[model samples]
Target: MENKLNDQKISSTIETEVLVVGAGNAGMMAAAAAAEKGAQVMIIEKEDSINLLRLGLAGVGTNAQKRAGMTIDKYELVEYLAAFAQHNVDEGLIYHWANNSAEAVNWVEDNILKPHGAHLRAEPDSLVTSSAYQGFSTENDPTIDDETFVSYGTWFQEKIAALGVNLSFKMALVKIIKEGNVAVAAIVKNISSGELIKINVSKGIILCTGGYSANEELLKKWNPLALKKNVYNDSPRNNGAGIVSALDIGAIKDEEPAECIFDRGLVPVGKKTEEMYVQTATYEDWLWLGSHPLLKVNLRGERFANESVPYQFTVNAASKQPGYLYAMIWDDNFDEYAKQFHTLGCARVGFPGYMANAKKLREDTQRYVDKGLVVQADSIEELAEKLQLPAENLKKTVLRNNELVKMNIDKDFGKEAYRLTPINKKPYYGCILGGRILCTSDGLRVNKKMEVLDANYEPIHNLYAAGNDSGGFFFGSYPDRVPGLAASHAQTFGRLAGQSAAK
Candidate 1:
């Protein structure tokens, strides 16, 4: 592929006022916004159809929120977001999203959702928002090619196409043509015919091609230390093509790449399967273990950081472990843990069994032990033996943990009293806990207007980046508590990029 790049001949050429790449949430939003501004918008999507898994989006102040009588302090929310990123995030960008997202949400609802009898489902919590289609039958719509088609993307594409925006499918971005430091055009490939087409941009090019989570090479280079463990990348299509093309034209990169890390079940080796592995021993073993307050210990049978902290911090501690796996140990008095406070208490994201039925959680635990996903022992020593850790170390750690339980204080890790669960009862159990990056948060550095910037902090002429392709939105780690941040960024920044590029 590299050798043929120099001799490659362009098959055809097209011109557009705004060229939007990738047809995911951000890309479609960008194209619609540009077209609404009367720009000749052309969207090139690599997939046969777009909006594969966009269930819903996030927004702060919207018609849905207003109807629900919900209000979030924009100032406090911005401060919370900045502090969540440890002040490594862009405050201007946060404020921009907080202020502008309501309009975008209302636009999407009014244009695509309301007509279909669907609406934005705003949870009682301000952060948790979703676009719920109440089983609205689309079988009557003639434009729906698939009989089973029911997604925000499908509705959004139809709406945009009606607005005179050209939607081209099976077209992949191969390269970007730059004049000096300005992005002038892009080289796109037709996946079916193996034909390359040049798209000249008269206004600007907005790259919503997503992040480098799907590219292993880019992951090893940028997010190596943080994501050393095996990852379960959710977006298999986001291969960093946009970031690479931007960098090839001297687009500045973000200072550090952030990862969307969360505690998940044991990932299978040698094959990529979306199978959900449920951990039985502790809270982290189950999927989306961020909200679960469980006691975790490293390979040396030593409690490291506060387990109740952010999920990314826990995953970071696991990366520092010997094999990038930690143990969540508990005792046979599992009924003591049967209280729904930690597991089923909080109404956060839920898996199949535990959150639904606590009794089913124990049943699943035993089943996993039978399946060898969890280790069960008649004693702590035996559990240690099975885990391949020093027996004395395990015993000592359990002893210290019991002492902490009695005192209602975690002297070493500074764990809260309510979270100090002692592993004292017979039939001790343990399960390995670890998680992988769902996506990357670092890419081409962009300003508040979503304009791709150069090293000198000047916007690259006619070049913009939205969604994960843009940077300065996140740093250090992805906060699980924030809920709808990623979807919100895509909506807010994608619209911002479109408006700016149209101007």
Candidate 2:
């Protein structure tokens, strides 16, 4: 493969069998898989290091699941995921993840994690056999402390390096140079030196450049609703470089607006949701109790939707409210009520089937209290006053909610009986909540083989994409009911793309 540079000021030219953009979880896995196949691979990243957040890696029929005495029907799981996306997603891609994810996860365990004195474990109490949405199990998480999750990424980085994968940091992808329809080279900018480097690839180029959560321009164009309804809480470096570069060369992408929105963005009292943006340092700022099925009211102090639903559903309900914000009201017995709520996903800390971080949850809530993000008062009226909501409406709403709790049946909204905890306890707490943009779910369309496709649904030669940069697996909204589905999809398709590209 050859391409003309066309009088461009190129500082250096390099050649490789496979070129991978982004050194995230997906990119690292791609580089490692290609190098393991004896292909010279170069992985580049704009940031200095990989993201250390330990995302839940969900997979079915893995060694960890077998050790936990768990079994899941892959067909049922795929169907459930398809329905979850309203059948707008590609079933082929979902089935691909369901079938190959186990092997990919086991490969990680054997080659990367276990070698570093770490292993994968199922979340306690994560398996759910009977439910409308069945086959729910804890994602395979590394057996490491939540604080030291960075070690997992570091270990994998070292393993890939030992496999002869070239890793470059501070290298930003500018565009893909294509000869007719085949991607042959990529022009990248050195972040530190402002130098352009062209890398010619003979085999393939894999893009795993994450999502456009931080790119305000892209959000305005593709997913403006997310911008208007949620606070930006993702990495600033993830600005849709890979998706844009691929689109520049006529790659097909999801036309619908989709995102991984969570209902935990804390809007301080008297502040609007639109005023809050780009809260990346949000560890201590997290409101774990916000996920609880507490009595939520709009700025007008009226209960809107059933609080027992998924996180994004709450955000969607709130988006219709006055300021795209809602207030979560809880009593002193929040700890007891939270346990009964049985929230899933990252919010399920201190509970079985997730991390045992009850202590951290308490500390985070206290920090929010200290910062006045969460207002505390002795009565509902006082709490309403502090939150700047109508006191009478809040008191009436609280009284109605307490009545529903006593009846063990939600008259207005069909909240579960167990989740109908009363808010009559003294020392009430409240916080205005909004949506938090976790990641943009829409991106370049790819097939089951992870090959980037053209507008006509044909494969773009020598081009592949994984992670948030690749789509056809998500639409409508993210299926948070299935924990770690996003990360597992990234790892699974990432490895597949690397192996396919190497060949």
Please tell me which predicted candidate would have the highest lDDT against the true structure: 2
User: Model 2, which residues run further than 4 Å from truth?
Assistant: 1-7, 127-135, 144-151, 279-284, 351-360
Cα lDDT tens digits, model 1, 1-503, are 54246226878789999999988778888998998889999999887877534443456677766766766667776776687678887788888887887787778778887787666655443222111101110001111221222356667878998989998999999888877767889999999999889898999999998888777678778877644553455567788999998888788878787877666554422122223322221233344333355667777877777776656678787777776767778877664554533432122323211233455456756766776756888888898877766789888988888998899887887765676677877788876666656668887888887889888889899999988898887887875454456767886788889988898
In the predicted model 2, the residue pairs found to clash are: 124-353
Candidates in order have lDDT scores of 0.70, 0.82
Q: lDDT tens string, model 2, 398-470?
A: 9999999899888898877777888877788899888877788798999877889998999999999998899
Provide the clash count, candidate 2: 1
Q: TM-scores for all candidates?
A: 0.81, 0.95
